[model samples]
Target chain A: MSNVSATLPRKARVPIFVVLVLVGISIAYPILYLAFTAFRTRADYLGNPFGLPSELTLQNFISVWNNYGIGRALLNTVIVVAVGLTVQLLVAGLAGFALARYPVPGARYISGALVSVMLIPSQVLIIPIYLLLSRIGLVGSLPGLILVYVATGLPFATFFLIVTYRSLDTSVLEAARVDGAGFWRTFLSVASPMAIPGLATLLVLQFIAMWNELLFAYILLPNDQLRLITPALAQIGGRFTNDQPFVAVGLILTALPPLLLLSFAAKYVMSGLGASFGR
Target chain B: MTSPVLAAPVASASAGATGARPPGRARWRTSERLVGIAAVAPAVVLVLGFMVYPVCYAIWISFNKTNGLSFDYVGLDNYTKLLADPLLHKVFLTNLIFLISVPLVILAALVCSVLLYERIRGWRFFRVLFFVPNVLSTAVIGLMFKSLFSYRGPINAVLAQFGIPPVDFFAGAGSAIFVIIIALVWSGFGYQTIILLSGLSAINPEIFEAATVDGAGWWKRLWYITLPNIRGVLALVSILNVLYTFTALFGFIFVMTAGGPGYDTTTLDYLIYTLAFSSTRLGEGAALAVMVFLLIGGLTALQLRVFRVSEEN
Candidate 1:
C-alpha cells in the first residue's frame, strides 16, 4: 500500500483524500440522516435529529404506508412510469429508426425540432398545457400526467435513439433490406437490438425523472388517487406536520426505488451521458 | 409483430425472382417508405399538440386577461405588468443571484472529476456516493435541507456546539439564499461530475504521458491537456448547468423557504407557478412564462454559438 501511494505525488495525497472524503461525507450525511430519522420516534427525532437511533422502530414506515397512502401513491407512480416509459420508447425508438434509416421526408426538421424543444423549460410549457388540458378535460387525470411525462422524456430519448440508430452498421441494415425486410422487419431484426443499450439508459433516467416529477403531477393530477409519489410524499409531510419520523419514512419510500435502479444501472447512466454529449 | 417477421421470408423469396425484380422491388420500397412515414407520425403529432400548439396558445394568453376560462383582450397589459410587478422583478433578481452557483458548481465538478480521473483510492465508491443525492427526489433533498437548517435543527445544533448561538438561517434573504445555494450545489455536483468524468476519460493518454515526460506538473497537464480536450463537454455542461439552475430550482426553493420570508428566493419558474396557480392570475403568469421562455431561448442560442466557436479553436 505504501509503495502504491508512492506513485501519486506524496505532498498532495493527504489533502486530496481529505477533500474527496469530505465530499463523500457531505453527500452521504443527509441521506443517512433521512434513513436514520425514519427509524426513530418523534421524541427521538426532536431530542436529537442528528444523532443515531438508540431504539429503532418501524411504526413510522407503517404509518407512512397506511395513513400517508404511500402504497397507493407508489402504485400510481409505477403506472405513470410504466406507461410513460413504454410509449416513450416506442415513439422515440420507431421515429428515430425511421429517420436514421429510411428516406423520411422532413426527417431533418422533425429531428431538429425535437431537440430544440429541450430549450423550452417544462415550466413554461406547463402553463399553456394546463389550459389546453382543462379544455380537453385531461386535467386531474393519470393519463394527463403520463402524457406530460412522455412528452418531457421524448426529446432526450429520441435524440439518443437517433444517434444510436445512426451509428449502427449501415451495411448490415443494407443486407437486411436486400433480404426484403421492410421498415418494421429491418428495425426489429437490426435497429431494436442495437438500441436496447441506449433504451435501457433512457429507461433508468426517465424512471427516476418521472418518479420524482412533482410539478406536472401536482398540476395535472389533482385527483388524490392519481397523485404520484413525490407530491404524495410532500403531502404526507404537510399532513403529518412535524411528525418528522413519518415524513422521513415517506422520504425513504420515495428515494429507495431510484437508489435500487441506480445501483443496478449506474454505469450505463454515466456512459449514456457520455454518448449523448460526446457526439 | 409476428406477421411482419413471417412476411420477411416470403418477401425475400418474391424479391429473388430475378426477372420481375425491378417492379416488385420498387413496389416494396414504396410501401417501406410509407411505413417509415407512419412510424414517425405519432411523435410528430405529440410535439405538435403538447409543445407547438401550447406555445402559440400561451402567446395569446399573454395578450389577454382571463376571467376564469374565458379571455378578454387586454392588449399588452400582462406584459407591462411584468415590469410593474415588484415580485416579478425580485424573482428575476433572485435568479440572477442564483446564477452565481452555475460556474462554481462546474468548477467544483471539474475538480472532483479530475480527482476521480486520477484513479484515487475508492474512486468508484466516491463517485457513487457523490451521486446519491441526485438519484433521490429533489423534494427529498429540499426537505432534508429545510429540516436541517431550521432554527432547532442539526446545523444550529452543531453551531451551538462551537459556542455560537443559533443563527436565524431563513430569517434574512442572504442566509436563506445561502442554504438553498448549498443544497443546489450538493444536489447537482454528481451530474456535472459524471459529465466531466466522461470528458476526462475521452482525453488520450499519450498526450498526458508526453506532458509528464516534459516535466510538467499536475496543474500544467490539466490546463494544457485535460482542459483543452474536454472543451466540448465543458461548454455543454456549462450551458446545461445554467439552464438547470434557472428552471429546476423550484423544488428546493419551494420546500426550503417557499420563496422565503419575503419572496427573496423565488425564481421565475416558482413565481410563474405561484402567479398562475396560487394567485389565479393566469394571464400575467402566461406573459411571464413567455418572457422566461424567450430569455432562456436567447441565452441558449448565445451559449451554443459561443461553445461552437470555442470548440472550433
Candidate 2:
C-alpha cells in the first residue's frame, strides 16, 4: 500500500484525500440523520440527534403507511411515471426523429420554437395549463397529469434526442434508405438501436422530472385517488402535523422510489444528463 | 434537429437516386409530410395551449384586475399596484438570493468533479453519495434540512460544541439566505458535478499526456488541456445550472422558514405561489410570472448564443 501511494505526490495526496473524506462525510451525514431520526423515539431524538436506537422499531414505517396511504400513493406515482415517460418518449422521439431526418417546410422554425419553449418557466405556464385542463375536465385525472408531464418534459427530451440523433453516423442511415426502408423502418431498425444509451438517459431524466413534479400535480389532482406521490406526501404531512415519524416516513416514501430508480440506472442517467452538455 | 444543410441533401437524395421515381413517390411524400406533422403536432399544440397563449393572456391580465374567476379590464391598474408593492421588491431580492447559490454551487461541483476525475478509489461511491440528495424530492429535502438547520438542531448543536453562539439561522434576511444557499448547494451540486465529471472525462487524454510530458503538473495540465477541452460542456452546464437554481422555489424556504422570520428568502417563484394562493392577487401574480418568464427567456437565449459559439469551435 505504501509502495502504491509512493507513485502519487505526498503533498498532493494528503489534501486531496482529506477533502474527499470531508465531502463524503458531509454527503452521508444527512442521510444517516434521516434514518436515525426515523427510527428513534421522539425523546430519543431530542436527547441525541446522532445516537443509535435503543430499541429498533418498525412503528414509524407502519404508522406512516397505514395512516398516510403511501401504498395507494405509490401506485399512483408508478402510473404517472410509467405513463408520463411512455408518452414523453413517444412524442419526443417522433418529434426528434422528424426534426433530424425529414426536410419538412418550416422544420427550422419548429425546431427553434421547441428549443425556445424550454426556457419558459413552468410558473408562467401552470395557470394556463390548469385553466385548460379544467375546461377539458382533465384537472383531476391521471391521464391529464400525464399529458401535462409529457408537454413539460418534451422540450428537453426532444432537444437531447435530436442532438444525439444528429451525432449518429449518417452512412448507416443512408444504407437503410438504399435498402428501401421507410422512415419508420429506418428509425426503429437503424436509428433507435444505436441511440439506446441516449434514449435510456432521456427516460431516466424524464422519469425523475415527472415523478418529482409538484406544481401541476398539486393543482390538478384534487382527489386523493388521483394525487401523485409528491403532492400526496405533502398532503399526508399536512394531515398529521404532530406525527414527526409519519412525516419522516412520508419523506422516505417520497424519496425511496426515485432513489431506487437512480441507483439502478445511475450510469445511464449520468451519461444521458451529461450528453447534452457534450460530455 | 438536422441542420437545413443536412435536410436539403437528404430530401434530394431520396428523390433523385432511385433510378426513375416510383409511381407512388408523390403519395409517399404526402404521407411523410402528414406523418411528420402528426408527430410534432401534439407537442407544438401543447406548448401553444399551455405556454404561448397563456403568456399572452397573462400580459393582458397585468393590465386588468381580476378577482378569482372574474375579469375587469382596469387598464394599468394591476401593473401600477404591482410597481407600488413592497413585497414584490422583496420577492425580487429573494430570487436574487437564490441566484447567489449558482456560482457557489458551480464552484463546489467543479472542485468535486476535478477530485473525482483524479481516478480516485471508490469514485463511484462518492458520486452516488453526492447525488443522493438530488434524487430525493425537493419537499422532502426541504423538510429534512429544516430539521438539520433548526435552532436546536444538529448544526447548531455542532456549533455549540465549538463554543460558538447558536446563531439565529433563519432569523434574518442574510442568514436565511445563507442557510438556503447551503441547502441549495448541498442538494444541487451533485447534478452539476456529474455533468462536470463527464465533461472532464470527455477531455481527450492525449492533450493532458502531452502536457504532462512537457513537465506540466496537475494544475498546469488542468488549466491548459482539460479546461479548454471541456469549455463547451462547462458553458452548457453553467447555463442550465443558473436557470434551474434561479427558478427553484426555495422549497426549503417555503417549508422551513415560510419565507420569513420576515420575507427574507421569498424568491420570485415562491412569491408567485404565495400571491396566488395566499394573497389571492391572481392578476399581480400573473404579471410577476410574466416578468420572470421574460427575464429567464432573455438570459437563456444569451447563454445559448455564448455556448453555441464555444460548441462551434
Candidate 3:
C-alpha cells in the first residue's frame, strides 16, 4: 500500500507530499501553539506570541488548577465520565445483545425507535430534559447530568453494539445455549468475552464523547464546583480574556484525556467513527 | 429466524425423541422471551423516561408560556411570538450562512483524501494528525481558535511581519462569522477526510490501473473515476456535515464568539441556549427548538432526495 502512487509521476509526488505536509502542519500548529503558550509566562506570550517560549514556567498550570477551580472540575468530570460510561455500556450492551440475538417481541420496532431517537436533534431535548431533571430533583447534580448522558448516549451506543453483536459468530452463542447457559450466563461467560474488541471500541468512543461533552454538562451542572472540564475551560476562557496562557492551560487539560485516548486507541476510535455514521 | 445456528440447535433438540412438541422448548422459549425483555428493559425505560418524555414535554412547552418550573397554557402564543421575532429570522440566516462551511469542508476533505489515497509517504501519520482535532473537545477547539484569531494573537503577529495591521477577527458580525466558518472547516475536514479515505479504499485498485492504461491523467482519473465512485460516501459526508452544522455547533459558538457582535454569529443551536437559559424565555426557546428540529429534518430529507437522485445516475 505504501508505494501505490503509480499514476503520479515522480515529479508530481513531491508537490503532493509538500501540500500534505503543509496541511498537516496547519492542522497541528494551533494545538502545538496552545502547548507552547501554556508553558510560557504571560509576558513572554504577549511579547512573542508566535515564537517559542523564552522561558518555561508552570505558573499558568498551577494557577489554573488552584485559583481557577480546575482541580474540582477535573474530579467532577472523572466522576461523571466514569459513572456515565459504565451505566451507558451496561444498558447499551445488554439491549444490543438481546436485540441482535434474541427473538425479542417488537425487536424491529424497538430498533427502529432507537435509530429515530438518534435523529432527534438534542437541542430540542435540552430545555425539557433540564426541566425534567429539575422536577425530579436531579437538576444541577452530577447524577442528573449522568442520567442525561446515558439517555442521550443510549441510542447510538446500543445501535453500535447491535451491529457488533450481530457480527459475532452465532455458533459460539449456540454452543453456550446448548450447554444450558442462560442469557445472563452466556452474556457474561461467552458472548461478551468474544465481543471485547467491539465493547472496547464502544468504550473508547463513549469515553471521549462523555469526556468532551459540553452542552449538557454545562447546562445540567450549573454549580461552578460541579462544572465538567470542558465547561470549566469554557468559563475560564470566557472570564479571563487577558490571560491567554492560563486559558491555554485549561484547554490543554480539557483536551488531554481524549488526545491521550486517541494516541493509544486510535484504531478503536477511528473504527467507531464508521459505526457512528452506519457506513 | 435467519439464524441457522439457532435453528440447528432447536431442530436437533426437537428431533431427539418423538416428533411431538419438546416439553422444555416452550419453557425455554418463554425464558428466552423473558430474558430478552429483561435485557432490553433498562435502555427502553431510560430512553422513554428521558428522551421521549422530554421531547413530548418540549412540544407542550413550545405551545405555552413558561419559564422553567411553571407553565400556563398559552396555546401557540409562544410559537406565534417566535414566528414574528426578528432575532429568530436573523439567527436562521446565520445558520444558513454557516451551511456554507459544509461544502468547504467536503472540498478540503476530497482533496486530502484523494492525495492520501495514493498511499504517499507518511500518509498514515498525516491521517492521524488530521483527525486529532476531531477528538479534542469543541470547547478546546473553539478556545484555541479564539486565541489564535484574537487581535493580539499569533495570527496578528504573523500579519505584522507582512506589515498588515492587526485585525479584530471577532469585532464585527462579518468577521466573527468568517472566523467561525474558518474554525468549522479547520476542525471538520479531517474527520470527513478519514471517512472519504475509507470510501476511497473501498474502490478497486484495478479501476485506477485500467484508467491509467486508458491514458487518463491523475486529475482526469480523479474527475471521471474517483469522484463518481465516492458519490455515495460524499453524500453521506455532506449530510453528516449539514446535520453537524445545524445541531452540533453550540459549544463552538458558545466559547468562540458567544454569538457575539450583536447576534451576528448566533446559530440556531446557540440561540436556543440563550433564550431558554440566559433570558429565561423557555417557552419561546422550546418553540425555536421545535422549529429548528423540523427545519433540520426537512433539510436532511431534501438533501437525501437530492443525493439519491444524483446517486441513481
Higher-ranked by DockQ: 1 or 3: 3
> What are the lDDT scores of the predictions, listed in order?
0.79, 0.73, 0.86
Writing each residue's lDDT as its tens digit, candidate 2 over A1-279 gives: 112222347677767777878998998778777766677666666665555667666788887778667788889889888878888887788778876765444556666677677767778876666666777889889888888787777778887887777778878877777788887898888999998988988888777777777878887898877777888776655565445556667777778778888889988766676544421
Instruction: Give the top-scoring candidate (lDDT).
Output: 3
The candidate, 1 or 2, that scores higher on lDDT is 1
Stretches off by above 4 angstroms in model 1 are A1-14, A239-241, A275-279, B1-28, B228-232, B307-313
Q: After superposition, which runs of candidate 2 have C-alpha atoms over 4 Å from their true positions?
A: A1-11, A165-194, A235-243, A276-279, B1-28, B160-168, B199-207, B210-214, B219-238, B301-313
Q: List clashing residue pairs in candidate 2.
A: none
True contacts kept of each: 0.50, 0.39, 0.76
Candidate 1 lDDT by residue in tens digits, B4-121: 4323453445333344222233444566656866787777677767887788988998898984488899999999978898878778888999988888889889889988887767
What is the model-wide C-alpha lDDT for candidate 2?
A: 0.73
Per-model DockQ: 0.40, 0.38, 0.57
